[model samples]
Target: MLAWYTAVVYAVAGAGVLADAGWWPTAALVAASSGLVLKAVWFDPWLTVGVLLDVGVITAVACSWPASVY
Candidate 1:
């Protein structure tokens, strides 16, 4: 149930990223997912995998190394 929502949110955020909708919206989605991740830490089988995926996405977006040089 929640895992499905997480997937949907990720899809939305991914689309926002592709559409150049700014990072704030994506960040908000990711932040919302953070709580879902924590909430699902108990019985959700997708928690580990989903969290890892979210961590990767958030890390990539939050990191500020270079815009056109990376």
Candidate 2:
């Protein structure tokens, strides 16, 4: 369940970056997604929080700049 949600979040971020997300925002999303994946792969307890935070941040950034997405 959690893994599926995380994967979806990554897809959104990747699509955003691939489309028209700015450099800094793209970098942030990449770094965040990478960290979350690392946590999940390692069975870290923080994985849940990390993924949730990443999703929230990504959603917020997207909502904040609807025009930035092209």
Candidate 3:
């Protein structure tokens, strides 16, 4: 199920973050980016909050990256 997959993705991303793994950013980005489409199909006002949070996470990640990567 899509919801189950979503849950797993979120869990993996969270775990990766907590563990400070080098790959966490990629996993987080995947979860956040996919949340955009998933939120659309399963529209909920609360989901909008999630999308906003995802945007914030993306911004934070981008800001943390070195300008050299740009």
Candidate 4:
């Protein structure tokens, strides 16, 4: 399901972070964004925490990125 796919993507992103791969941020951002869309399509009260986590991930990635890329 979408949740499983998102979890796998997040695991890959986490590994990329540990490995210091240049694409980690992009992967994380994509996964987080997809997760947000998924939640929006299938809204649930219990999923609010997940929405917050996705937003946090997006914010972290954006903040840590170099200004030159923007």
Candidate 5:
């Protein structure tokens, strides 16, 4: 039951990202990544690293692009 609930939450969050509703998608992704970091601290440090990498890539892309293009 809990797994089902979590999946539903994640699905809604993914839909929000697809809809391009501004910062909510980024915020949700960050929050979920934080949770993973906490839960997998011992065996899965890569999860946190991946999250940081994602942030870096997004930041680089955003910086490399001009807002006026939007």
Candidate 6:
């Protein structure tokens, strides 16, 4: 049950990112989804921290504005 919910959350977050939605909202959703999944999967503390950090970095990169100055 928890796993299913977590998957759904991740799917929703992925869809949001693919949709090119706003950065903050997408980052927040992804972080929340990852957290839920990590907890549900009972991942090791260090592994979970790593996963979270990766997600945060990815989200930051994705949200970063391009260097092109129109």
Among the numbered candidates, top lDDT falls to 4
lDDT of each: 0.58, 0.64, 0.73, 0.88, 0.52, 0.57
Residues 1-70 of candidate 3 have per-residue lDDT tens digits of 6666666787897787677677767776777777766887889887778889878867767686534333
After superposing candidate 1 on the true structure, give the runs of residues whose Cα lies further than 4 Å from its correct spot. Answer: 23-32, 35-50, 65-70
Question: Which ten residues in a row are the worst by lDDT in model 5?
Answer: 61-70
TM-score ranking, high to low: 4, 3, 1, 2, 6, 5
Estimate, for each residue in 1-70, the C-alpha lDDT of model 2 and write its tens digit. 6556656666776666677655546655665666566666776665678768867766766576556554
Regarding TM-score, does 3 or 5 come out ahead?
3
Cα deviation of 49 in candidate 5 (Å)? 11
lDDT by residue for model 6 over 1-70, one digit each (tens)?
6556656765665666667655435544555656656665787666776566546745655665232310
Q: Rank order by lDDT, top first?
A: 4, 3, 2, 1, 6, 5
How close is every model to the real structure, measured as TM-score? 0.54, 0.45, 0.73, 0.84, 0.36, 0.42
**Best by the TM-score measure:** 4
Superposed by TM-score, candidate 4 places the C-alpha of residue 52 at a distance from the truth, in angstroms, of 0.4
1 versus 3: better TM-score goes to: 3
User: Ten consecutive residues with minimal summed lDDT in candidate 1?
Assistant: 61-70
Decide which is better by TM-score, 5 or 6. 6
Tell me how candidate 4 scores on lDDT. Answer: 0.88
Clashing pairs in 2: none
Alpha-carbon runs more than 4 Å astray in model 5: 22-70
For each predicted model, how many residue pairs clash, with residues at least 3 apart or on different chains?
A: 0, 0, 0, 0, 0, 0
In the predicted model 3, the residue pairs found to clash are: none
Clashing pairs in 1: none
| Number of the candidate with higher lDDT, 4 or 5 | 4
Candidate 3 vs. true structure, TM-score: 0.73
Better structure of 4 and 5 per TM-score: 4
Model 3 accuracy (lDDT, Cα): 0.73
